[model samples]
Target chain A: MKHSTNRLFSLGAIVAAALMAGCVPPSAIKPVDNLSQIDNGKVIVVGKIELTPELEPDEQVLGSSYEEYRNLALVITDTELRQPADQLGIGALTRRINAPLGDNFFVSHEAQPFFILRSWLVMNAEIKVVSPNYVHVPGNAPLLGMFGIDVQPDDRAIYIGTIRYHRDTFFGTEKVEVIDNYQQAKNEFASKFGEQVQLRKSLAMPVMNN
Target chain B: MKGWVKKTHCFNGLTLLAVALLAGCAFSGGGRSIDDPTSSLVFGYMDMEEAPTSMDYVKLQQVAPRSEAGYWDMGTDDGIMYNQYVPPGSFKVAHFGGSSFLMGEHRYSFPTYGRNATAVTIEVPGIYFIGAYAYQEVDTGFFEADKFSIEPTENPSEKELLNTLLTMDWVEGTQWESRIKNRLAELQ
Candidate 1:
């Protein structure tokens, strides 16, 4: 009886770990340590994500909380926004931004233009009783919500402005706005990469309204 | 005795979870014979460079006629033919791919933007041909990500497909032959 009980407990733990593994956050891009890292046909893209009425520790429970934002990931694709972006696809790249709010940057190959296909968030309540949930802004319709950023061949640093997500009472995305805050973003990039690295303002604008 | 009962309960719970996960890969309904051809049906041909095996399938998502918004999964025959009894509405090729021993699972989504997007509207569908497409994988690099392109092409014409259907046992006595012929004529 004791042996059987031990086996059952071991099996349960493995299953739980496998389930949790799917929600494990993708690795965040490391901040640039030197100027040469952004060289060699590579460009640094900077942006910020803001979640209004952020998730609070008290709201972490089994049921739905005030806001379930845990990890926000921006999916970048190489001129293939016609179909929905598959983060795992070869042409697609994902940069995970730490939850709630902060400035983030990612390095990309310079020659090819990139588009911010969409943003998806993983909602894992701090308490471990429940599994994680996912929420995608723009909810898979219209397909015109993609933002395009064109990088010039010689451009070293590009700032795509700030993306603000407004959540409703049910935590569904009520609205998404791309606001130009290039001055502050420029300052942040300067402080990190130093004043020598030129920060170019290339705010991402909505491609179409359809 | 209490430990034994707890072990059994735990085993049952794990079994249920495993079953639920595996159920997602179950074959979606495809190639089922339709009694009445007059009912709505959507059919298409996919000419893949490397044909998909029995493990592969395609999916269509109904976008318009909001009342019937849902997905239809259609398994292929020789990775070429796919037919489903979809309602009369606007549908889009959401994605298509399958698992293989060597390649594992791969899915390619049709473009949802620009002119190359894959979509068709069946306003008054007896039967609708969504067009023939050529699917090819783009070689990015050895260690680079996999990329693919799906484009519309005119090959294995509608008449040829109609002739092929006429030979099938399912279409012999039914109205499918005439319906497909009519659809071809409508396209002309």
Candidate 2:
């Protein structure tokens, strides 16, 4: 009976996992660095983003220049997705990007501040399977590439790590150089994200309609 | 009477086996990678305008209004963190068509810590619980490698996420990925 019960539980887990994360056959679920850490590159892309009005509205951390008005976080991580608003016991979800895409997390706050409503998701390297969950997000650094860090001034991918907890809080490590790379990304992100800013604003029309 | 003794002996043996088996699968995986299929990690990234001076998160007592930001702390094992008892978000990092242990791989989180260009390693394997808190500058601390010691992290959590998802990890590279993959398959 105990053995059977265990089997039943395992089956349930597989089924439930399938439902939550679209039907990726249990076998297709590859092993990345973390077992539970689903490889977003394959199954999904792992990047979570939020839009918040800095107290100064003009203040930004990860951006290369305040003129760029954007910041890129590196999220050097070692944790799991906790709860909504990020509490514990929640299925592990994160905005951690190990191998980022050109469009991994481009946000046009200045161009489409309206479309800047808060949202989060996990995707594979392809940027496909974006599972966006809406929540009253508070704050998190995108792999924190703090400004003035030695990070580059041109477009580049900054490598960062973190130990995220399902419980909203996360811990990470970053370097001045990487922050610079992210800053570079920001420099270009602002320009690139700016082009789409108008369209992003246009997309938010429906929300405004409501 | 003799037959009863045989059954009792068998029962004891089974119990011992059960303990060993249960304990055998106690340890598991961490992190994620994209280009490297060999890695075992899955995480997201965000872009911020300004770095947070002091970043902290709290649980909302209710399903907060858009006017506010902060996480709601309802405790459960799975589903959208916003959905009643659902997990964080409804997304799946592909399960490597492996086995039960692989499934286990999908059930944990591993974080790496160090200054840029440094490697952190966890030499042993065991069950460790994680509790997150802001540390005094060192600014952001990744529970230093040596800090991965097995301890009771008195973090508040619902029975499921704590028991099922947030099982901790401290290992070399992302080896936990394959370790958990093989482990999860054994059960099936």
Score each candidate by Cα lDDT: 0.51, 0.22
Tell me the DockQ of each model, to 2 decimals. 0.02, 0.03
Worst 10 residues of 2 chain B by lDDT: B1-10
In model 1, the clashing pairs are: A82-B111, A82-B112, A82-B113, A83-B112
Tens-digit per-residue lDDT, B39-144, candidate 2: 3222211111122111111121211121122122222211212111211221211100001211111111112111111111112232122222121112223532
Give the poorly placed runs of model 2, Cα more than 4 Å off.
A1-13, A16-106, A110-210, B1-17, B20-188
C-alpha DockQ for predicted model 1:
0.02
Clashes of each: 4, 106
* Deviation from native of the Cα of residue A183 in model 1, angstroms: 20
Docking class of 2: incorrect
Instruction: Choose the strongest candidate by TM-score.
Output: 1
Interface RMSD of each: 17.8, 17.9
Tens digits of lDDT, candidate 1, A101-163: 555655444545676665544332222222121111112111124677878888888887877
Top-DockQ structure, candidate number:
2
- Runs of candidate 1 with Cα error greater than 4 angstroms are A1-210, B1-33, B36-38, B51-57, B61-75, B94-117, B141-145
